[model samples]
Target chain A: ADLQQGRAKANACAVCHGQNGLASHPEAPNLAGQPIIYVTQQLKNYKTGRRTNEIMSVIAKPLSEQDIDDLALWYSSMQVEVKMAN
Target chain B: ADLQQGRAKANACAVCHGQNGLASHPEAPNLAGQPIIYVTQQLKNYKTGRRTNEIMSVIAKPLSEQDIDDLALWYSSMQVEVKMAN
Candidate 1:
């Protein structure tokens, strides 16, 4: 999948997982720099009902395998840093 | 439940969720400042098999209700910031 296409396709995901995949919500996991295998596996799990989250299930339900691959690749390619507060 | 006790019990969780509840692993959600209700509900779901996660289910299985409450409270009280990359 083209990285640019993946970035474009990830617009909806940016609502929760920031535009860069760093997670906008505390309840949402940061997807940037995640292992591609892990991200793909979870998406597949959500799609198959092996892992069920109300929102994730609905979001992943219609994603084609190619879409999943694109998303996984896009997210894994982004970078994130942990900023700790004192 | 004591907040201190919750912090102590959360040592195991810090492997994935940082000591302050910001996730260390991309697969883990940042728990800091999440709604207490959401955190508590998800833990219970994991414990009850309603949410099936290979790691979380096992970790949540033995927690008492009090433990869950403390964990929820502790995590909710923490603060985190989103750092975006350019």
Candidate 2:
């Protein structure tokens, strides 16, 4: 699949993590540039309930492993926009 | 007294977190736009040994509460540059 597919699958994440994956909430972290391995692990955490965020768990539950890989790779490949001012 | 003072005090943070607060490492979260309260709390955590990163501890220990506040405000006020691909 392409990044488009990954982006589509990632739609559920846009609410908390902006459309481009920049985090909108103070507690939620921006997933931009996150290591693919770390991203996959966090998805696993959400899937397995090891990391407990109600919305994250709900979102992660439906994803197959392939979907997770695709999304992780897509997100990792995209550039994060400037979120904070220096 | 200004962002300049905060920036000077924040020089030590530049090694891991880039000069603009964008994290270079996969594991390190970019401190850009992080809530000032959270940033202060994390600094406090580092100082007190509640959060354990060797560098973070070294950097946090000597900071007085005012220093921490200044740094926190400075970092929070600054914009985080794009570090990852979108």
Candidate 3:
């Protein structure tokens, strides 16, 4: 359920963020396997303009806290496939 | 050297993103212990406009590839203190 709503909310995100959350965009960070707390915090930033992105701000502006929670749950639930030295 | 340089780069970031990379800003994502690749990729995104943040983009704009590498190296090298449910 959370994942489903996250996927739905992810529509705007997928353009740059990608369907798998692994961004193909050179600049976009791959969220496929990012920590939920990290993801949640970022979404909050976009909502408040702390980390202002024109598109993301608009998309995030209307999102309620529950909506943010749902999206965070959905994105963080997925496994990250990209491997780099840890 | 990398850590020092990253600390320098982190000045603009620390306002919203805490000195430790755990963001006090509701929307900003914490980067203290994010994966290097993820951090690198996100930095690249801000530089290229894929993920636009006014402050970040400006700060990121002047950063060279090596600077990006250094900052990414520094941030990912730290231990993430904020634990969330995984």
Candidate 4:
């Protein structure tokens, strides 16, 4: 999967998960630095109804296997840091 | 609700959501800095079956209203920052 292409594809995810995978909403999970296997499996689970989430199910439904792989790879490669509130 | 008490109560949530509210897993969201109303509502939804997650539902099942409020306040009071990978 092309990392740049994956990043481009990730734009749609920014509304909830931030541009870099940090979530904009409390309801959405941070995808940055997650294990690619875990990310891939969850997307597949959502797509297959093994796991259910209203938004994730819809988002995962239209993604092809390659798309899923690309997305997982992209997110998993990003770095995440948690900073204390000043 | 006491913020300190809320923080203390939030320890159980740390396994999935990090000790400071960033998630340890992609499956869980960063709860830091969320709108308290949003956090509170989601917890209630999980508690009431309006939203479903294998883990969240189980965790929320035993919470009292005060527990929910304290948690919401604790998480919402936290600060979150997302930085790009170097």
- Selected candidate, larger lDDT, 1 vs 4: 4
Ranking by lDDT: 4, 1, 2, 3
lDDT of 4 at A55: 94
- Mark the 10 consecutive residues where model 3 chain A has the least summed lDDT: A77-86
User: How well is each residue in B1-86 modelled by candidate 1, as lDDT tens digits?
Assistant: 56777777889899997776756786776666665677888899899999877799999999999999988878766654433323
**Tens digits of per-residue lDDT for model 3, B1-86:** 37677778777778886776655675566555566777887788889987776677888888789888888887676653212224
lDDT of candidate 1 over A1-86, digit per residue (tens): 66666777889899987776756776776566665677888899899988888799999999999899988888767654443323
Q: Which candidate's TM-score is highest? A: 4
- Displacement of residue B49 (Cα, Å) in model 4 is 3.8
Scored against the true structure, residue B20 in model 4 reaches a CA lDDT of 73
Best by lDDT: 4
How big is the positional error of residue A25 in model 4, measured in Å on the Cα after superposition? Answer: 5.7
A76 Cα displacement, candidate 1 (Å): 3.9
User: Which digits, one per residue and each the tens of the lDDT, describe model 2 over residues A1-86?
Assistant: 36677778777777776666667766566666555666887788789876556577798898998899888886676654444443
Put down candidate 4 lDDT per residue, B1-86, tens digits, no spaces. 66887888999999987897766786676566666777888799889977677898999999999999999889777655555544
> What TM-score does candidate 4 reach?
0.70
The segments of candidate 3 whose C-alpha lies over 4 angstroms from its true place after superposition are: A1-68, A71-86, B81-86
lDDT for A44 (candidate 4): 93
Chain B vs. true chain B: TM-score per candidate: 0.90, 0.81, 0.83, 0.91
- Root-mean-square deviation (CA) per prediction: 3.7, 4.6, 7.3, 3.5
3 or 4: which has the higher lDDT? Answer: 4
